[model samples]
Target: MSDSRQFQVALSLLPYVGAKTAKTLVSYCGSAEEVFSAPSSRLLKAPNVGQRIIKSIKENKSQALEEANKQLSIAEREDVKILIYTDKGYPKRLLRHEDSPYILYYKGNADLNAQKTVGIVGTRKATEYGKAMTQKIVRDLTRYNPLIISGLAYGIDIFSHKASLECGLDTVGVMANGLDKIYPPAHKNTAFDMIDQGGLLTEGCFGTMPDPSRFPQRNRVIAGLSDVLIVVEAAKKGGALITANIANYYNCEVFAVPGNLEAMASEGCNKLIRNHQAHIYTSVEDIEYILKWDLDERTTKPIKKSVGQLTMEEQIIMNKLEEDGGTMAIDSLSIKTQIPLGQLASQLLMMEMKGIVKALPGKQFKVVH
Candidate 1:
């Protein structure tokens, strides 16, 4: 590991600073190295940087760096990839979140920033219906070739991973514990298979054990990494619901597979849909439609329109769609076009009505051939 990365790892290891606080420190100091070297007065000026955290940074600077070096050595031995926030290999979508981790230990070959990604989460005590739905969704989603993400826990989590692997799709297992250990130990074989096909990702270090509190934090990473989060089955409360809420907060599309209203596993999905927190998911087509994923790329090509015949705004939007591989999130398009949201929405609606473009469920759009 480089000195900068080592420092970042060290900074993340500090007990006084979580992901959010770490982000603030880095933003204020300009770099992780600078955070450690900057004067106490300079550190205090950063938002949420209190006296206690400053003291921790000052007193444990040497110890933290030493520990970081040891962690790096362990990572090297384990063939784990240490990705700092600024690293090219880091997940781009996750990095957008305010509380995204400063250091991620990854072990896998799958692209962390795959063009299409979905997080499938649900109850650990999965029912038969839940298992069937999970498999079916993964199988159908293969057509879009999306990277599958799930917490590598029991029930729905393991089922999603297994189904993805069976469908020849890349899948990532986000763990609550360190990469050195796979929780539920029963899923060890599945985890091993993923390392070659996709990867095992975590913010936890080598010695960190699985704890109840860590799972919610892990769920946020799952929410952040995905473009959409699919709740296969969940109770009225569980980590899946936590992930769904986080995904919504991140402005990522959330989808839930509905079940019999009386079923325990279906309550979360039903509630999310009723509350307008998630879209009702019935088929893979719903996913493809919402994400603007083209079943046939040829069909998504822009309709022929002479530059002279189109409005300047229309032309600009079309260019952006083309640049973004024929699909883009509406928020991204609005920002790229520098068009106000209301005006952009009106324009997109007009385009959709004219069949010049199509709108997907998640405020995503694409040019129609």
Candidate 2:
């Protein structure tokens, strides 16, 4: 890669140099090359340069250089792009965060920065409602063509990526480890699709597998990149909640889809809504309403309705289907409306016969208009 890029990556490996300290160092010495060449005495005089840091720099300079070189070699081998905080291509939204990484290793489409970003997060052990809601809301949001950002963990995270891809939306999966491998290897296929579709992102260097400790560290990046963070479902404690907390810290709008009060999977969502940590979103309209994102223009052309009337139950089901952009499952509608399954089936059949709705493979019903 570029010498300038190498110097910047080298700076990341310097003893005690973090994002904030690196900024000061670059400002003090004028460039990464200058900082490397500057005398210890001169470096100590730089703003916020502590004597301990200076001593580490002086004593470990060779070791630090070796480490940096190793990392660069690995990155070159993998064809990964390393973006320093100072790079123009570094995501601007992330740069605004207080603890943004000094350097990040990324692979796949670099054009992910070209689109608006939205985060979809929630519990790993998702419920049916959570799964359906995540899928439905993301399907609606994809019409806007926003980039999807989420941790690569299972449950809601995978669902988010899957739904986004299905709708032809580019998606970025933030990993808690290096891009050299996928975490929860079950998501390998999804991860592969994401590399070409959007990308994989992480601040951790090459060969660093995602340890438990790194995930909480990883959540901030997800929060920083997106303009809005939506928690589809969560328990009282889960990575999604941590991501939501980080998003709130970044001043990004936090949204939680309202869930059943009695469901174990929804406890965290209920808490978020109750404590005002997140706005209540039962549908995409709630998200658009709070963010003032216009859905009218982004929404797909409404399917045409035939010149026919409908029975009372069929009419109610049709309206619900319309509200969801013509996608609703029988079980979900039955639960939502407190209608018996047998009755709901009769209504769906009547609606389907009238051409008011169409039945999908997944037992999902969609309104024609």
Candidate 3:
């Protein structure tokens, strides 16, 4: 890496030098190298700089360099890529936010500067309603090529990533920890796959473990990277709420899928709607209406079947199969797509009888082209 890159890494490690502070320092000093080369007196003149921060900057310079080089070694071993704020490829939406990070570590194929980005977030312990909403919104959003952004936690986050992958949409999973490790080890496999299909992004440097305090801070990044934030479900309190709040602060459109009021998972979403903090979405059409984004002609085509032609369950299964490839294995597709196997079998039989799908050998099924 060049001197500029090294300076960015150094600045990020400073105790009180957060994204906003770094931006101010860099803006005043002309560049990260210039900031580093500036005297302590001159550095303290920058906004939000405290005496303690100034002392740490002067005293921690050597230690910061050693740690930065170590972080680079770790990043190299993991094949993770780092981007500084000045780098052309750093996410444009995030940079436009009030306090975007100066350095980001990412691993994936997604373009950070994707055309339209939407965030899907919710509680960890999700309801069936939340799962269904997540699947529906993600499948619809994929038709427009919007980059899906979310934390890689359980419930809505994982559901969004899985659905986006199923629909072949690019996604970005933001983390609260260093890129060197995944916080929730259960998501290790999903994180690995995202590197090839989507991406894992973070503002934290190497060797930093996920601390509880970092999550709320991490939520800002999720909100900043997105043009719109959709809360699939949430309890009365959770990280999703934090992201939604940040989205509001950023003046981005915040949306929530309504759920049964009796369910615990719907509490936060209901509150958001009741308090007028978020717009409610019944379908992707509602989101499109609010954001004024044109829907793809392919996705907007009405299902051509008559009401009497297919049962409600069959219609849903057919829609999923169509959004995906029309051909899918009866079992794996049932699991991944969240359709009940018995219902799916019945639906397939009805479709087959109606000439909508043809049954293949070994229990496989393919829709009639």
Candidate 4:
């Protein structure tokens, strides 16, 4: 609703600019609003700012802005939350990735940055085994209270969402289309329940149909939003495998439930594990151990220690947690501490071990006290 946000939404709707180019434009111009106002000569100075893109930006400025206003109006009327890349509520994990969407239209009460988040994906033609595995994994994950993310497609996707709901866990449906309509239409009731318990998320705008090409883009969001992506079952190729690969690329952990070597549903998971693309997932403990979520469920918060006794990195992270009201996303902490993600993750794990901090569900940390 702010003019700047309207501009950002408009900039995102540009014909030629996508996540990458939009990032470039924002980096060069300092903001989406500035990009639209910038002279063509100045825009050309940015890398990959060729004449074609620049022309599209200039030519579509008015139309895009008009459309953005209309889109925002619809979102407001429909109770959708429009999250820009720089917004506080934007998924911190996704923001850390290079190819994250410029804007997202979300309609949900669930925190996008829940302390523990997992993406459950698999083949659309799910097997009985796949469905059972999805239910079991989701039910087991209830102890950790993770937010479940999945594409709202048929087979495994729907099964995951329904299972999460039955287990009383919040589950988000990431759609290839806009929020205006649910894809596969049959999952309408499940989606309706999610809006209150978890909610639907999408990068697409109103009127955007579930085009086949857009599903890959949708898969990337599923990968980015999750701390770990689980492949309950998959084939040699499908949206689930695509999500696993993307999750790996983003430095998020990928887990595959191994199945019969010859079974069609298990082939993809088996290949991923055999080829070293993903870890072999047998039980909930594997996920708990890898993510270090194995902390005693009943462990009470430890008393705080003096800053003098802490390591430099630990003290810095602690101070940031204090500043952030005793909690912060891992990515936000990394940015505040000026620490590399890999190093930050390691330090946080060590801190968790020391009882100096507690890892929450959505990749967040809080001082134990």
Best by lDDT: 4
> What is the TM-score of each predicted model, taking all chains together?
0.87, 0.76, 0.78, 0.84
Q: CA RMSD for every model?
A: 3.9, 15.2, 16.0, 4.4
lDDT of 2: 0.80
- State residue 23's C-alpha deviation in candidate 1, in Å: 2.3
Q: How many clashing residue pairs are found in candidate 3?
A: 0
For model 2, how does the per-residue alpha-carbon lDDT over 227-264 read when each residue is reduced to its tens digit? 78999889999898999998887768888987788888
Worst 10 residues of 2 by lDDT: 295-304
Full-model lDDT for every candidate: 0.89, 0.80, 0.82, 0.90
Give lDDT: candidate 4, residue 287.
Answer: 85
lDDT of 4 by residue, 325-354 (tens): 898878888889999999999998888777
The reply for model 2, stretches above 4 Å from the true place, is 295-369
Sort every candidate by lDDT, greatest first: 4, 1, 3, 2
TM-score, predicted candidate 4 vs. hidden true structure:
0.84
- Candidate 4 residue pairs that clash: 114-362, 115-361, 115-362, 115-363, 116-361, 116-362
Which candidate order results from sorting by TM-score in descending order?
A: 1, 4, 3, 2
lDDT of 3 by residue, 73-176 (tens): 77888888888888898887776466788889988899988878899999999878788888889888876899999999988999899888888998889999
What is the alpha-carbon RMSD of candidate 4 to the true structure?
4.4
State the displacement of the C-alpha of residue 222, model 4, in Å, after optimal TM-score superposition. 0.5
